[model samples]
Target: MLVTLEGLDGSGKTTVWERLRSDDMVPDETVFTREPTDTWYGDAVQRSIDDDDADSLAELFLYTADHAAHLSNTVRPALEENRLVVSDRYSDSRYAYQGATLADSEMLDDPLSYVREVHAPWTRPPDRTVYLDLDPETAAKRSGATNKFETADYLATVRDNYERLIEADPERFVRVDATADPDTVYERVRDAIV
Candidate 1:
């Protein structure tokens, strides 16, 4: 089973994923990973994230390359061996974040759809996705507004994209409120997964 944890930065995705990875409740052989992965492709993505003037389209491709490499190098093999796979962030993040980035560019009339279509043919869809729900302002504050992607205004657009994703595939997404205390949020995420 491929279970993905997704949300805006500081929505507690990495924190929850870390705890879940160590929790006794999960399977011992479960495979935990994230994207952009810890590869050179990921390094490039990180650089792009730091570049305030990076082209939206270029950034999207960087994310796509990382996802492809991640699948080939990790996700596919783990699933083939019947291990439970959990990712902190996956393709959805690209679709949401990059979609928002390109929204005002006028290069693509439907940025979200375009991003999804780019990955539709090759990406492996998660069996389930846990969306940590939080307001954009709170998410920005929690994330420290560190980069272009962490701002409240931008996160709001990303949130809208996420909502569209959920609406399109309601069955695959499990929504969890992130406003609760850390322990409560962790418990909720654990329950949703287990």
Candidate 2:
């Protein structure tokens, strides 16, 4: 089974993934991974992220490349072995964050749709997704507004894209409020997973 944890940068999905790694509740052989993976492709994506003036289309493709590498190198092999796969972020991150980034450009009529279409052909769909929900202001604060994507205004647009994704595939996603205390949020996420 493939499960993905998704939300804004500071929504605690990464924290939850870390906790899950040490928890006895989750399967011992479960594979936990993330995107922009710790690879050369991801390195390029990180570089683009730090460059505020980076071309939106270029950044999107960089992220897409990292995700593709993540699948081929890690996610696919684990799933082929029938191991439980839990990823901190997946293609949905591209659909949300990159879609928001490209919103102002005249490149595509619907950025979110365009992002999804780009991934639709080869991406492996998660069996379930735990979406940690938080307001944009709070998310920005928690994330420290460290990067262009962490800004409240940009996060708000990203949040909207997430909502659209959840609406389109309600059955695959479970929403967990991220405004609660860390323990509470983590518990809810773990519960949603197992």
Candidate 3:
């Protein structure tokens, strides 16, 4: 099972992942990994994140490269061995973040479709995705970074993109109200996945 937790930074994904990891129900073979993986491509993506002038398309491609490397090096191997895989972020982040940022650019008519099309060839979608929904103001406050995509307005657009992705395939997502305490949020995520 490839389970992924998706939300804005400081939306408690790490906290929830820790709780899930410590829970007794999780299998021993479960392998935990995250995007912007520990690779050259991932390094590029991280660097690009802090670059104010970075092109949206460049960021998208960087993320895509990191994703491909992460899948081949981590996710696929774990799955091949019959172990469950839990990831921090995945295709949805690409669609949400990049789609929102690219929306105003002359890159493509539909940034969402462009992202989706680019990722169509990647194998294995998450068995389940938990989207911790929170207002942009709260999420922004929770996250202290002042990176290019950390603004409230940008996050709001990203949330809208996330909503569209969820609407496009409702069954694949478990929406959780993330304004509650960390333990409470984990409870929702636990319930959703269990």
Could you give candidate 3's per-residue lDDT for residues 41-131 as a string of tens digits?
A: 8889999998899988888999998898888999988989988888988889999999998999875999988999998987578989999
Global lDDT scores for all candidate models:
0.94, 0.93, 0.87
Q: What is candidate 2's local distance difference test score? A: 0.93
The local distance difference test score of model 3 is: 0.87
| Candidate 1 residue 27 C-alpha distance from true site, Å | 0.4
Off by over 4 Å in 2: none
User: Which residue pairs clash within candidate 3?
Assistant: none
lDDT of 1 by residue, 99-166 (tens): 99999876799999999999999899999999999999999999999898999999999999999999
Per-residue error for 113 in candidate 2, Å, reads 0.3
lDDT ranking of the models: 1, 2, 3
List candidate 1 stretches off by more than 4 Å.
Answer: none
Candidate 1 lDDT (Cα, 0 to 1): 0.94
Q: Please give, for residues 71-112, the per-residue lDDT of candidate 2 as tens digits.
A: 999999999999999999999999999899999988689999
